[model samples]
Target: MVTPRLIVFTDRRQAARPLDEVVNRAIDGGARVFVLREDDLPAAERAELAARLGAMVAGAGGRLVLEEGPELRKCHGLADLVGAAEDGVDLATLSPIYPTRSKPGYGPPLGLAGLGRMALAVSIPVYALGGVDSPARVRDCLDQGAAGVAVMGAVMRADDPARFVKELLTA
Candidate 1:
């Protein structure tokens, strides 16, 4: 099966613009994978949002993943990687690969070597997350054996999300 190389993470709290607008723009600009990381929303609201986003993503020939909530199909977070693997998750994100302002207090950044080790340790595809705002960073993650790179602030805060996503995909 094909895996997305560029994944956009959504956090309503960190968004400078409307979340849906940013997401739609990114999708239009070729972002094929998205992780709904809005942990602040109530369960019902979150599920509703996920359903809506899931439909949108599917219509665009993409995939939507949920950050650790009720969704048992996929998982996100470095600590959950092992459990996710054991639960048969095919694609997982191991985050904070680099220092990121988006996720404060998550812990110290895991450098390239750490990322490489985690990627090697996992049997499933590992997408690097955190501080991935540029093409070079994306390349670095790929070089370190990551299946892809996931980002939040980079696209969500862009003045032109579509253009940003286009540039990111090219990178």
Candidate 2:
């Protein structure tokens, strides 16, 4: 199957403008999937943010995925979210699959082989996250059965987020 498109992990708070504006810009910038990962905000606030952001993204013909947090608690994050793509959420992002941006003090990196095993247990496409600094590694992730790779600092903090995404998507 053809890859849907680049999935951007957007930090609504990181942008100077409102969350809706940031999301609109991201969609305009060719971001097909957005993971609403504002961990600092409360659950209710996150839900509200997701609703607004979701509307803006859908208006732009893009998609939004709400991450409940790193632990996938209380119906927050889950692989099942992919099934709700039309209803608002789109695809789950299982992070720290290898030492990720969220939890640095966590256990050892869940190497690709181990990650593949874990991903096999789930039904939806899994995006390998954490420590992804090279686009070539995308092949390894896909080989290990990952749907895709999600990067934080590797893309957002890059000198060129667009170019970084191009390389990652092409990889």
- Scored by lDDT, the top model is 1
lDDT of 1 by residue, 2-55 (tens): 688887989877676888888888999999888898888898998899998899
Q: Lowest summed lDDT over 10 consecutive residues: which window, candidate 2?
A: 69-78
Task: Give all candidates' CA lDDT scores.
Answer: 0.80, 0.61
Model 1 lDDT, full chain set? 0.80
Instruction: Report the lDDT tens digits of candidate 2 across residue range 1-171.
Output: 224535666665444455565556545556667777787889799778888888877887766766654322111133434333323433344456555554576557777886577556666556777677577777788788777776654555555555566677778
Q: For residue 164, what is the lDDT in candidate 2?
A: 60
Mark the regions of model 2 whose C-alpha exceeds 4 Å error after superposition: 1-6, 12-29, 42-56, 69-90
